[model samples]
Target: MDGARLDQFDRKILSLLQADGRLTNNDLSERVNLSPSQCSRRRQRLEDDGFIKGYRAVLDRDRLGFPLVNVISVTLATHNRDNAQRFADLVAKLPEVQEAHALTGEMDYILKVVTPDLKSLADFVNGVLLPHEAVQHVKTAIVLQTLKETSALPL
Candidate 1:
C-alpha cells in the first residue's frame, strides 16, 4: 500500500511494533484501542504490503561479547560496476560487518563493524579488507561511547 494510504491506526501499529516487536496482538490491540482480530488483520495487511519487513530480537553487543565497534571509511581502487558489485558481495558474507553504505563524499563506502576485541577487529581489517582487490584505502575510528543509538522511527 502507498504510504499516503496509511491511516492513524496503521501508523500507531507501526510505532508500537517498532518499539517492541514481541507485543502480542491482544496487547497491541489494547494499547491501540482496537479489537484483537482487527489488530491482527491490520498487522497482517501491513506485513503483506511490505510495511513490516520482519521481526528480530535486538541484542546488546557488549553483553554478547562484541564490545568493539568501529566505523571504517573505505575507498575503492576503481569506481567500475564490477568492482562495486564484488565489494558488496564480499561485505555481505562478512559476519563482522554490521552495516555498509555507499556514500556521496570522498569515501566510496563506510562500514560499521563489530568484534569481540581489538585483535579481532585488526584481524578482520588486515586479513579480509586489505587483501581484497577492490579495496584501495581504509580508515577506521573506534567508538568510545554511544550517546544515543536507536532503531525507532517517529510516526
Candidate 2:
C-alpha cells in the first residue's frame, strides 16, 4: 500500500515488524495497543499488499566463517543487453555475492561480497569474475570497519 493509506497503527506495525520480525501477534498487539485479532488482520493485509515481504533471520557472517566483506566495482567488456544479462545471471548463482546493483556512473555495476578470507576473495575475483566474458575490469576494496548497517526504514 501507498504511504498515504497507512494509518498510525499500520505505521507502528511496520516499524515493529522491521525491528523484530519474529514478534507474535499477541506481543505486537500489546505494543500497538490493538487487539490480537485486529493486529493479525492488519499484518495479513500488510503482507498481502506487498508492504511486508517474506521474513528471514539475519545470520552472523563471522560466526558462519565469512569474515571478509568487499565492495567490488565491475565494468562490462561491452555495453549491451546480452553482456548485462550474462553478468546478472552469473552473479545470481554465486552465494558469496550478497548484493549487486547496476549503476549510472563510471562503473557498470557494484557488488557486495562476503568471503572467508583474503585468499578466497582473490580467488573469486581472479578465477570467477575476471574470467567471465561479460567482465572487463574489476576493482575490489575490503571493508575495514562498518560504522553503520541497518535494514530498518524510518516510518
TM-score per candidate, in order?
Answer: 0.97, 0.98
TM-score of 2: 0.98
Worst 10 residues of 1 by lDDT: 146-155
Backbone clashes, candidate 2: 0
What count of clashes does model 1 give? 0
Model 2 alpha-carbon drift over 4 Å, by segment: none
| lDDT for model 2 | 0.96
Cα miss at 109, model 1 (Å)? 0.4
Instruction: Report RMSD (Å) for each prediction in the order shown.
Output: 0.8, 0.7
Query: Number of clashes in every candidate structure?
Result: 0, 0
Best by lDDT: 2
Clashing pairs in 1: none
